[model samples]
Target: MGKKDKKKEKDVGKEIVKDKKKKSKVVKSEDGIPIITAASAIILIGIAIYGYTVYQDLAQVPEMPELDLNVWWGQNTTEPQDTSIRPYRIVFSDAMESEIRWLFEMYRRPNKKKSFEDTAWNYGVHSEAFAQFFSYWIFKYSFIQRPKFLNKFDHFKTNIQGLDIHYIHVKPNVDANTKVLPLLLLHGWPGSVREFYEAIPLLTTKREGYDFVFEVIVPSLPGFVFSEAPARRGLSPHQMAIIMRNLMHRIGHKQYYVQGGDFGHAVGSNIATIFPNDVLGFHTNLPVNFSKLAYLTWVFGSVWPTFVAGEHVDKLYPFADKVKFLLEEFGYMHLQSTKPDTVGIALQDSPAGLAAYVLDKFMIFTDPANKNDPEGGVQKYFTYDKLLDNIMLHWISGSIATSMRLYKECIADAEVEQVFSQIPTPVPTWGLRFKHELAHSPDFVLKWKYPNLVGTTNVDFGGHFAAFERPEEFSSDVFKAVKAFLSFKK
Candidate 1:
């Protein structure tokens, strides 16, 4: 019996040895050549894809034209008085050119921390890029007309709500058959009328079988970009609404649709509320929820123990996640709201810093679902090139400090609860809520009064900067909403 047991143990040992050899062989085979080869192939493929995208981008970027453009600086309207009723030709003076050159240099300088270097933060980075692009026409070549059209944009000064306001008006080529909607586009802070360059094609042109066209009017917000800064304190949102209404009247847009995002959203909402009869309807990509804060308070207070115990999962539905997002993302707003000039002056001087500041928000907020990140976390939602384009506008215009003050002023007068609860808009409204638009989720939005909401397009594509990132999708949604308005009328 002992001899038989010894033989059995030996047989078991042999089996174990055979199994180990098999496992070893399999591991060796996977690691030896195939895995390394596959990884190398993947890297090569990624490089190829990146190269192609870069090529495509380079190919598409339009060139700057040499049309003797002007940079008129200082107090009031400075332009060559139009004898031919043509565009007022303005050229940058030597001093102005030097200032711009300095601006670009400040942006490109190396960061305090090498690892923390932000591409967008670089000064003059945007201006240099755009100016370079503008200087040489790419194959697509239509945008060279921008500088040419610059002179055509009529600049005017008017005092509205005790603040001197400035604006640009571009009338459509009126003809016997030309029928266009009067469209008023407002710019948010850290941006100007320049942000609409990409979207202008869709905004103001005649599409085939689409009889609809637009007499596009883009404006610099009060105390932002080229618009006159407020002389006094307490420039209420409601007061701004009055100013916008008057501006529209001045531009001959008696009844027009209003579109806005960010601070533009507040302005548009206010316009709709103040002058419902004049403003036809309102549309916004950045849908705000007045009820979100109230709902969050209620939910948190009700489930105090669950929240305290770190088991509050239900609130993640919309309201809670929004709060978390606000905490995580809005540090810039907090600082700017309190001390605009502080950050503004620093960013104004450091183009790189401004680029980083603006670019980070555009990247994170636009598409929290980072398609570029292989690890499946939000690295950046926007393309670097597009991000650069927006920042360039700020840099070229030299309006970084002026832009930040909009936030500082708005926040000081911000009675969120009062504004949200008190205002009731009768104008037809539509909201295109992107996936990552925090408090703008459907569940959360439904908690508020969407009295004027004609349609809500819950887009599967894009994030905060939907207009730029997913232009086709964004345009389609915009047209659809407009159709909804028309459909109801018919």
Candidate 2:
């Protein structure tokens, strides 16, 4: 038991302590295996459920409303109806002029009209803009010649669904050997057949390299302009689609292409969705997909936007910012969708108030930046006479109230939309995405809804009113779309 024996004893104790610690670490590692395996199994099961949900949604084909071609919208018809296609004319009758004169006179009165200091359209139509518009309407708007210009395009009316359906039907002035295709052009709120007036000639006439031209038919939606209003309560968007289809059938067209914007987009989309075989192609300026997959893909895009959107990523991403802007912009939609009759009474009564209400929307929609323009830059895209032509049409016909009701009809039944949301049509589609458009869905996202999406044209200008704002570009896109649609595999 000397110094060497003592040193060896200390070394042996240290080894024994280290071995116990190693055994304890091995036991702890073994205990965690089941927890790790259970966690992985849970994650795998969740992933499988998510995949199935997405697949089930993708495979869904929505059940559309069963509508009747014989369903009449007119009220209490006691006699045999005249279904003849008759020529129609727009007249600025003395009686209508007399009614308009007094309304403009009241708008001329100097009153306590004011807006907050330095605030622009953020508060609504700028005060100065409100005055400037009416001044032009009273002094410059030609109620006389504007009607002639609007009538230059041949208009006709025929009884359909017991209502006198008014439409502008134009034939292509091309060679007889060239093909003539039927095109159903549509309009939305605050817009009429007049919106397509500038684009109609372009579409109907010849284009380079294309052998076919569109025999364009633009309709003043039922309850708007010269078209007869529905007598009953059920003229929803789906019903509007039915009316439009019947109009085409009455015009001797079995199938046709469709191009629309705003609520026109809704009706046109419905037509394609319900009768895929009847519509040759669907073209829209405000293209959006309501399918559940579109929503899921959009949320997925937020995390990795490059995967969902490419150059237009900014338009789709920072989702919260877009949500905020939509909530801000949709106040009008909420009002019109819920109680259009309330405000419709005012718009139907006052030409000036109606101009202000619609022009404010035009200003912001043409370019969101115009919301900051104290003078309101609507004149940049349209003429004073042309602007009043649209405003006066609503006023003269007293269709403001009826036209506004369309918004309510469109959103009234959530079930109709819930069913529509699942439909993915085989109809070929095209999207004209403008730079300042309120929202944009890239090609990948659009494919889920429009599987036959042939193309998307990203214009470097304009906003909501494409045909009115940039007719040349809009018409060009329509031509391109029709060409692709014809050649595309069904």
Candidate 3:
């Protein structure tokens, strides 16, 4: 009876094993590869790819390019260069005055295509509002006193690396106890030394609590209004940083603080990254970090903004919305980065055309919300004569083409990332975030590029051109930042 039962149990176990094998066969891939094995292989490959991309942001940095310290950019490089600083005057000759009248006459003519009804700066510097200002610049604005205003600053030119570098040097009138620190104030495109005219007085003045006063040097960057343009290619921001370093050295400054915005931010970042030893401190209103880790952190923090946004969640979260808003303002950036010469011609040909092109930037960069108003609050923030003064300088120089060449240089060479975008600078850094600044970079992300970030000063007003628009507030912010920078150093 036991032998019969054992034989029946063995037959049942064999039937159960055959059924399990049939189900396993159904789970296998078409090529007979196990499903789990195939899934594991794909997952491993993805992890490898992810590591390759993120490693550089975390630790890997590209080698810095070997730049030519004495590279010649001028056409007459063969001749012995004049390195002596010389006094320069911004003149309005009779011939130039006649040209201004001619441009004025040309600009006064009614446009065949009128502005779309009810659209403000949304359609790019409302043609209606712009025309009225253009008329004021021509007839009512005082060109008689404008030159005097621009010339009020101490303007000088010195040849550096075969190019004429124009700058305004203003020293503080202070007591012996006060420390006068050299501060390099760099301005970006659509800006000239004129941008610093208002800030010069305030920056040079002594603050009560601080023992230091800034001896400001505002340079018209090469290819800008008074500075000579390079004759050849390859003058990216890094190269510009070299020129700035040399310029400061030439001015007897071994180490100085740097402050910038826009393309100035790009060049200043490079200076801080490559010439960290020479930069005592750095500051920027448009604080941005372009490293891969910074982007990854930003995206990762999207799920939980408290990780990256800190207290300024509204300004940075909903990454797609921020990106979309940026895209709307970046049309000019794309054009200048790709084909600077083409837009340069459009800007250089007609004074009115240049006004329309750059003033629109003034509208948006000053405050994105400016586009909502008919007048754009441009007049509210800046007086008519001063605004016209800036436009006139651009017109007089016809530098729109060459000044914009920096954009083309930076993108084409891709030198920015190799030099600083992926690299963090140890220089004591401070960020001033204006409520209306074009871009917002919270201190959390900024720390990736600026590991020694001393502090971030957040203001309720102002935008990109902080120094130009709100000199007092901008100066106060600068004072507080420099104090923090000194504290960090100590």
Best by TM-score: 3
User: Each candidate: what lDDT?
Assistant: 0.58, 0.84, 0.84
Cα displacement (Å) at residue 380, model 2:
1.5
Model 1 over residues 188-305: C-alpha lDDT tens digits?
6555665565676676656665557677777777776545566555554545666777777766678998887766777777777666788776778876655434344445654563
lDDT, model 1: 0.58
Looking at candidate 1, the ten consecutive residues that score lowest on lDDT are 64-73
Estimate the TM-score for candidate 3. Answer: 0.90
Candidate 2 residues 1-490, lDDT tens each?
A: 9999999999999999999988755553355655556677899999999988867656666566676867788978689988899999888898888888887787676674698768888888888777787777777777788888989989999998889989999998878889999999989889888888889889988978999998999999999988989987778877888899989998999899999898788889888988898999999999887666677778888998888888888778788887877787779989988898899998888878898888877778888788787877868888877677888788778888889888787777656765775777899999999988877777877877788999888877888988988889999999998899989998
> At residue 74, what lDDT does model 2 achieve?
90
Q: Write the per-residue lDDT of candidate 3 for residues 343-416, one digit (tens) a residue.
A: 89988878888888888888788888888898887787888777777778878887889999988898877845
Model 2 / residue 346 / CA error / Å: 1.0
How do all models score by TM-score? 0.65, 0.86, 0.90
TM-score of 2: 0.86
- Higher-scoring candidate on TM-score, 2 or 3: 3
lDDT of 3 at 229: 94
Pitting candidate 1 against candidate 2, the one with the higher TM-score is: 2
